[model samples]
Target: MAKLRLFVDRLSQPSRAIIIFCLANGLDAEENLVDLGKGEHRKPEYKAINPMGQVPAVDDDGFYLFESHAILRYLASAYPNVKEHWYPVDVKKRAQIECILDWHHTNLRRGSAGLVMNRVIAPALGHPLDPKAASECEALVKASLDTINTLWLNEDGSFLKGSSEPSIADLSLACEVTQLQFLGEETKAKILSPYPKVRNWLDAVEKATSPHFESAHEKLRTLAAIFEQRRESQSSEQPAAQSDL
Candidate 1:
């Protein structure tokens, strides 16, 4: 069988999840960088691979797949040698993970993307901030965190779904929360402080997937730094603009 070809932009949360999963499992695959910043994913050649022109698509031999969650499941199933905890065979466990993945799309993932785009991407794109949209997204994120804290995580379980080990659900959700890194430290802390369980779960996921998780997130770290610098520059200019007014 041919090795999988993963098309990804590391700065993307889902892309980081896929990359970290593959690396953690020692999967037979090669990373094909799809530079989202350069609009590489939108190019005609790339569009041929995925009509949506999204990063984190994969090509296994001639078969192509999109959507980060679907890609994660396919990889886990195709490579049986991967750890069972990732996509478990046990019916109840598997169902639990599947349920979490499905809920994630509409809840955590959606909110995280909206928040990151509005708070960080909009400024960088020279677009004015939309306070209403940002507030809505923040509410969604907070609600999702509340669900994870009160429902998904068990007091005795180290991961979501009460699994003894971390699963793709954990990875997916952790990546979403990590998007908060784009905000300033104070803002990030204020948003996350109420969810102690979510924070503990994130720490566990980071520990389990680490080194690879950290490696895959290098792009996000750099992007966060860039956002911070831009915010600082904007802040410095605000006083001058006010003085002139």
Candidate 2:
């Protein structure tokens, strides 16, 4: 069997999920870093691999696959020897997981991506933050959290689908929501405070996928630290500037 080649930028939530899945399952894959910052994904070479030029693409020998969720489902189906909980064989259970993955794209993923792009990526790209857009995205995120807390999570279990074990859906949603951790503490709290279930689910997911989860998110953690330091510097300088004035 050809070793799967994963083209990814860990900073991407979906990419991180794929990385965690592959590592957690012990899939035979080689990591191919595509630096979005360097526009590596946009180059002609990579565009040929995935015209959409997204991270979390996979090449199994010559067979190419894109879209993180698709890749995840393919991996789970192809590698049946993996733990059953990740992608169960039972028809209803598998369907439920699929349902969550489908809902994820338009709901949780949309808001999370928007929040991160507006709050973090936009600033890095030298674009001013759009207050309206940020607010709207924040609302979407909160709404998604409400639904997840009230509906998706099981009353008896720690993961989605009411399974004691984590699944692909858990990894996907967890990665999506944790994007908020990149924001300042106050901003993060504002977005996360009302949803204790979401917070607890995140903690459970982190515990279930640990080490690998933490490893895949190193870049995000670093970015959060940098943002915190920058904010602190600006805050300290504000008083000095005011004193001089």
Candidate 3:
């Protein structure tokens, strides 16, 4: 069988999730970098692979697939070696996971990705920061976190939906929360500290995935440092500019 080809950028939460899943499961796969920073994902070559031109797309032989959740489900079913815990065969269990995945896009993704993009990524990409949008997104993020803490997670298990082991849904949401690492420590804590259960589940997911989780997030951490430095520099300049005024 031909190895699956994953086109991904680690900076993307979904992309990192896919990469971590493959590594954790020991799947036979090849990673192809789709550098979103350089607009590589927008090129004609990448568009051919994924008409939507998104990171975290996969090519299983000639079968092309986009959308991280779909890719995860496909990989779990198509690969014989994948552990059932990731996507259980029991109908109810799988449905529970699916419920989380479906809720994730509108609730979690918007808030998490929106906050990151508005606060850090947008300015770097030449869009000025929008404080109003950022505030709205942050509110959504906190609401989503509250939901996760009170609803999705339970004392019966460490993973999402109270599963004993981590599932693709767990990896998906964990990576989304990981994006908060790029925010300044004070801001990150402000957003996350209210939900201790959410934080614990995140740690559990990382531990379950192990070294692969750290490896996949390496670039995100590097960029987080750079973003922090940039924020500090801007802050120092702001004081001087105010003094001049």
State which candidate has the highest TM-score. 3
Candidate 2 error regions (>4 Å): 236-245
Alpha-carbon RMSD to native, per candidate? 2.9, 3.3, 2.7
**In model 1, what lDDT does residue 108 have?**
90
Give the winner by lDDT: 1 or 3: 3
Q: Write the per-residue lDDT of candidate 1 for residues 1-245, one digit (tens) a residue.
A: 53789899888888989999998999888899999878899899999999999988999988999999899888888987788899999898899899999999999988888887876688566787676787799899999999999899855788997777999999989988888888766677788899898888888888898789878877788888887777777768785541211
Question: Model 3 lDDT vs. the true structure?
Answer: 0.90
**Candidate 2 lDDT, 62-112, residue by residue in tens:** 889999989988898888667889988899999999999999998889988
Better of 2 and 3 by TM-score: 3
Residues 1-245 of candidate 3: C-alpha lDDT, one tens digit per residue: 44699999999999999999999999988989999999999999999999998898999988999999999999999999999999999999899989999999998999998888887789678788776887799899999999999999865899888888999999999999999987866678778898999989988998999999999999998999888887777779786541211
* lDDT (Cα atoms) of all candidates against the true structure: 0.85, 0.85, 0.90
Judge candidate 2 at residue 206 and give its lDDT: 85
Of 1 and 3, the candidate ahead on TM-score is: 3
Task: Please give the range of 10 consecutive residues that has the lowest summed lDDT in model 2.
Answer: 236-245
Winner on lDDT between 2 and 3 is 3
